[model samples]
Target: MKYIKIKRVMDFIFSLILLIVISPIMLCAAVAIKCGGQGPVLFKQERPGKDGVIFTIYKFRTMRLETEKDGHPLSDMERMTRVGMMLRKLSIDELPQLLNILRGNMSFIGPRPLLIQYLERYTPEQMRRHDVTPGISGWAQINGRNGIDWETRFEYDLWYVKNISFLTDLKIFLGTLAVILGTRGVNQSKSQTMEEFGVATKSLKG
Candidate 1:
């Protein structure tokens, strides 16, 4: 239990340091997102954090503002700009989450914060994924990211929740670097995000 306290301190200190160290890159990313399209530089969305609490998650905007081309809605891939794609490829879009970490809304390592809508879909067991603070990169992320199915991802998340430790976190941190550098498991679809969690997948009562 003391490690939880240690992890929070480390999350705060490291997030602060990393933000300062990466400010230049963050600035360029912001500018590029701004000039790349007509939308806001930063994308903000509500996500469920620990205990299913809602919090605003931040990322560099990686999709165009327009939802439709000519009455028909554009697909996510079609709406993605070249610069946005580059940022997503390099994981630059996630850098803004350091602010979330600093604010105690997230961790550097843990189960990832998922969509607000997913709150109701999770079974009682699956909802345990939020027993700890969400992270920028997590066990499910390093293992398969968006490439894996929701059930498997939730399993890995719960595994991490049960086994969180310095060594486990270290492994995830190093593995995250490899995943980013190797561009592994980055997408489950051409949309570059996971498909929505379906109600049909809820096998257990909430």
Candidate 2:
């Protein structure tokens, strides 16, 4: 349990320092978002955290609030503004979640939090991901991000839960930084943002 305590301390300290270091960038992103369109600068959504606890996760708004003439939502691709696309491609949209880490709502390394509604869809085995606090950067994200299939993503998440350690967290942190630094691209929409986890699937059946 030493490393677990270390992880929480690191989450608080590093998140605080990084937020201060990156405040300028976050501010610029906010300004750009405002200049781009009419919408909130931050996109806050309810996500499941440790042990299925619901919490509001924050990210920079990376899409426009565009609706059709009839006021229905537009497709993700269609609603994505140019600035938003660039922000996502550079992984800058995730910078705000550093605050979530500092706030104890998330960890620096664990399973990335997913939609609250996906709670009931997970099998008992898959639901094991909630055994640890959710994270901003995780094993699944450093692997293929949204490019991988759902089953594969869940597998990586569960693996992380079972094998978490100081070295594991360090490795994931370095790997995620490599992604943000352009050594590896974190494509948020190679297919799409893995948003279709609402239905129970046979792959998740015990």
Which candidate gets the maximum lDDT versus the true structure? 1
**Candidate 1 per-residue C-alpha lDDT over 12-47 given as tens digits, one digit per residue, 9 for 90 to 100:** 999999999999999999888777768789999999
Residue-level lDDT tens digits of model 2 in 32-139: 999998999999999999999899999999876764547665667677788988888788888899989999999879999988777878889899999999998899
The predictions' CA RMSDs to the true structure, in order, are 1.6, 2.2
In candidate 2, which residue pairs get closer than 3 Å at backbone N, Cα or C atoms, i.e. clash? Answer: none
Which window of ten consecutive residues has the lowest lDDT sum in model 1? 197-206
Local distance difference test scores for all models: 0.89, 0.84
Model 2, TM vs. native: 0.91
lDDT of 2 at 45: 96
